[model samples]
Target chain A: MQWLTIYKKECLESARNYKWVWVPLVFILFCIMDPLTTYYLPQILESTGGLPDGATFDIPTPPAANVFMMSISQINTLGVLVIALITMGTIAGERKSGVAELILVKPVSYTAYVTAKWAAHVTLVLLSIFVGLIASWYYVQLLFGDVSFIHALSTAGFYGLYIIFVISISLFMNTWTKTPGLVLFLTISIIMILNLVTSVFSHLLEWSPTNITSYLPSLLRTGEVGQDLWLASLFTIVTIVLLLFGAIQTLKRKEIV
Target chain B: MIQLKNLTKTFDKQYAVKNITFNLPSGKCVALLGPNGAGKTTTLKMIAGLMHPTSGQVELANGVKGDIRKYIGYLPQHPQFHSWMTGMEFLHYVARLSHIPKHESQKLAEQLLDRVGIADAKNRKISKYSGGMKQRLGIAQAMIHKPSVLLLDEPVSALDPIGRRDVLNLMEELKQETTLLYSTHILGDAEEASDEILLMHKGAIVESGSLQDVKERHQVDKITLRFDGNMKAYKEKMEEFPFVTHTDIQKQKIHVYVQNVPEARDVLLELVSKEQWPLLFFEVGQTTLEDLFMKVVNEHAMADHL
Candidate 1:
């Protein structure tokens, strides 16, 4: 119940800051541009080329599933950056500004405080991603052809798990650092390193959470779910839970002075 | 009532509050008086459950030992609020955190805002509030839970004269309804507002008692006299008197500490009459808390040097 109150406050704060509105706007904008750019590339090449007398250009219309995959890739980079920017100050800012002392001095539990922040961030991430994916699907249908709604939704669900994983890592980093800049730097670095290491050593690290990002595009393109995808999804969910638990412990022992 | 038994807090292997023990009787306002770095804030934070004591315990009136924060209201020396939140919103948030019923929390927040005299500005964001207004809002939130004991750390030390008076007046009114304990370096404010004084120096309670009792214990027989004639000659002559133990002369006034006021008064009057020295004013009384606080703090400094 107390968590609910705190969660509402977080949501209200995001609304007041216009993060809830603008973040999804950015996402939807990126999603729409992906399909529109793919559709117009041949015309753009011809207009800008001024090709020599015998030069020839051949461009093919890509599949709608491929357009959806292209949109996911765009979201994988920009969406993660947006999520990091939004949540970097969730915990550390409160501690730095002395607001934590006031709230913690009450009868409320530390678990509730951390969980409320996690839930709020998850809500925003999921909402923005859902809207962006649906918009991307609509644009793909209009510009290219029809893509299966179930496949797109399933891909988004799997992909949303990876975004939640990033958000939890952000919450954990915030608990460990007092500076929001440091939290952003550390969270991005950790995710990038994890993704790079798992991709390089894919034979050994197939079940890593980073695999979820790779599997997202393939799942949307191929319309097939592999055993590796199932394992990676399970690993991503477990990692998020563990990160939240770690965040709670770190915050419980945090010194507000 | 609140009891602190051997409550101590250590920072970096050094004692901030060391084996301190005291009792605050129910419905009485107590002032924790000390100089800066005297561990007054540390002690209050410990009781407020904001900091854990190194080796002791704070037991409430019912003898409940742990997690008594719900029953105590605390205001830090410099309170911080979410600048984006309006005063009413912040209070409602705090009241809800204390688990007040949803319907009652709104009414309680309004009552508290009015009580703190900030109801008119309750709709304005806290960032727009002045320092004094923020302090008043701090007080209102601290009292929102209606806790049994209110712990304020240097509540009025940072305010201007008018702001200080407003907070002090609010505290005076609050002590009538709850057990209020506040720490301050201002001896005059403590004397004016508190029923009891706990004088702390170097992480220890050097003196603790009711205002009257502490004064009586440290009181000395002293008389202050101001003259209209040559002050130097009068000071020298008065210093020569046998009953006069010590004399501090400044300009036209001389403060004479005596062994017995009656004997010193008779002798001084006779000397003044015989010499026909012009006199303007005279007063005799015990030492004020200001004097006592300075005496205690200075003695501690001297003892440290020794």
Candidate 2:
């Protein structure tokens, strides 16, 4: 695609400046902190056992899966917020900074620009999730025995899709709003709307973007790709298409004054 | 060549750009001059394909297919960039949008960042960059693709003198590779940089030509001579002549306005023969850009007033 140049550039920048240097440092620190906190929480709870149902602890025996899951929560789990922050800067920040006018003038169409943004964001998000997962995997092995590794890897696939879906949704929100604060607020509002609506219609809503929000948790809860997994995938794809199309059109047609 | 034929851009019932026909040839800069809301930017946007003209075609030269955008570099009135991106990242992202290969995007982006003089600050996040720095990065991103037509709308309005000079110099440098279509009300800039001026007033081109050619429109040979007696009769008589456009009698002086002063002088010499009037002063005033602008605006305003 015409957007590949921008996409690759985004990947390199994100890798070098965004996570390659930042996430691992943060995650490694969390790696220590996560286990240390988990390890000591039980003792702390036991010491404070005199309190009525206070300081009750459910600390996991430092297993690979537990460390990995904790690491995922610490690093990759900011998926929504991180992706939202990244996407908001893509279109909204550019527009606000007045760089859009300059770029749009150069033989780049609104479609190509928007698509490039979508692709760059998706690539970054996927990389972030994968890198964090891999890091967690490494730490998990260091912490617990290899036996704790999820024997069925299908769950990871479902989780990967779910996280990517969250990223796509975040990018879509970024495109819709150029203000970071607004996108942040909008992302939360959208997630809340989807979650609230889907929860109300729990078993009925199949093709809702919000359902994809649970795709990761669902895989963790149920090892198989349930109705929610397929439904979430479907919802994410459809919404991504529609939102990206709208973003492209808006970008192409709007004057960058 | 960029030909906008009858390019009408209407918002609601108010026609922002009404039946605009203009030709921007390759390798020539066309300065779009107008007051606020005169539709200069709208017309430029239509050419840049940022806004679709309500009714008309923005046809590019040589029938370039699949969106003429590849051939165009547009610097909007206000440039924007991804906040999370550095000045360098902004260019990189634009390189991707331009279809530059992944392997080459970084080199090209770095090159552009250097070209725009933001190389030192390239690593700084765009949100942290200054307005002029952001604009420089904006220019870098727009030029990264080396497009054929560069559309710069008020490209220097935000910059300080140095930034403006850099941007202007960059424009001059870019002209070696691409045509520059700049839009601004700053007549001095139009005079300094543009090969031609497209004067827009009231949603239409009141004048379009080389600066000199446009200045010719308001060129007038004016002379005033005092009559021995009342000059009202002479003023009245001068107006009757087809050659005399405007004649006024103020106190004892008779003022005569003519297209060709020398020829009008010859005619006035004949008038001297017929009736004796004290010759006062004669001067030829060539039109300036400001004069042309005023003349066109006044003519249009008068027409509308009528």
Candidate 3:
């Protein structure tokens, strides 16, 4: 119940700061622009003076489902950056400004305080992804061919988990440092390192969470799930839980000075 | 009532508050008197459970088991709030965190706003609030849970005179409801507002007692005489009087410590009239808290010097 109250305050703060509006706008813009440009690539290229006058090149227009999946893939990098940027300051800024001390000085439990922040960030990330995915579904169907609504929903759900994973890292880093900028830099750097390792050693790192980001688009195009998808997701879910738990313990041990 | 047992906090191999113990009885306003860096804030934070002591414990009188925080309402020296929030919203949020019912929180927040005299600005954003208004709002939020012990750290040290008077009066009324322990360096405010005093120096308590008791313990019979003439010469002449046990010159005033204040006063006045000394003022009373504070702090400094 105490967690719920804190969650509401967090949401209200986000709403007032225009985070709820602009973050989804960034997603919707990326999703809309991806499909619209892909559909008109041939004409857009020809108009730019086709390959040194008289040389012509063919550009393939993929299926609507593929275009929608491509947009999700683009969101893979930019979306993670957005999530890290917003979540970097949630805990660190409060602690720096002494607001955390005031709140924790009350009867509020450490678990309630940290978990509420985690839930709020997860809620906002999930909502923005849902809205952006729906908008992209409309644009892809209009410009290219047919893609099922259920396909988009499942893609959003899978990718939303990956985004929540990013948010969890930001929250964990926030507890470790007082500088929000450092939280942002460290979170992005860690994710980038994981992504690079997953690509370079795919078989060895099959059960890694970063593998899920690379596999989600293919899963949407074909009705096939990667062999390690379940294992990777299990790891991601467990990691998210562990990270939140680590955050709570860190906050408990590092009471305000 | 709250009992602090051997409370000690050390940072980076240095003691911020060291091996201090005191009990705060219920329904009394005790002032923790100390200069800056005397560890008053650290001691209060330890009691508020905002900081864990390197050693020792703070226990409530009832011996209640879990989470001593619910029973303590602490206002830091500089209170920081969510500046984007309205006063009403902040208080309501605090009340909800304390597990007050949603419907009741609104009413309680409003009532507290009126109690703290910030009701008029309840709807305004806290970013626009003046320092004193924020201090009052901080006090209101701390009391939202109706905690048994209210620990305020330098509540009025940052306020102007009017704001200080307002907070002092509010504290006077509040002591009737809960045990109030606040820290301050302003001796005059403490003298006017508190029932007891705890004088801390160099991270340890140097003195602790009720206002009357501490004063009586260090009581003296003295006459203070000020003149336009040379203060050292007057001090020398005054010391020769038989009733005048000793004398010291301070700020052009002669403090004549005597065995008998009445006999000393009569003799000093007669000598002044006969010699036509330029006596600017004459005061007969016990030593003020300012005198005691300087004496005690200087004594500690001299001890540390050795």
Winning candidate number (DockQ): 3
Tens-digit per-residue lDDT, A43-156, candidate 3: 787798657766656677787777888788778878888889999999899988998878989899888888899899889888888888899999888888888777677767
| Model 1: residues with Cα > 4 Å off, grouped in runs | A45-53, B160-163, B223-258, B261-285
Model 3's CAPRI class is: medium
Model 3 stretches astray by more than 4 angstroms: A46-51, A63-66, B225-250, B254-282
TM-score of 3: 0.92
DockQ of 2: 0.38
lDDT at B87 for candidate 1? Answer: 98
Candidate scoring better on TM-score of 1 and 2:
1
lDDT (Cα, tens digit) per residue for candidate 1, span B41-107: 8898888777778988899878777779898998988889988999999999999999998889999
Error of 1 at B38 (Å): 1.9
Q: Can you give the DockQ of every candidate in the order shown?
A: 0.57, 0.38, 0.75
lDDT of 3 by residue, B101-131 (tens): 9999999999999999999999999999999
**Which clashing pairs does model 3 show?**
none
Cα lDDT tens digits for candidate 2, A80-152: 5655666666667766665555666565656766777677666555655565555555555555556223531
Alpha-carbon interface RMSD of model 2? 3.4
**lDDT (tens digit, per residue) of candidate 1 on A132-208:** 98999999989999888988999999888888999999999999988999999999999899989998999888789
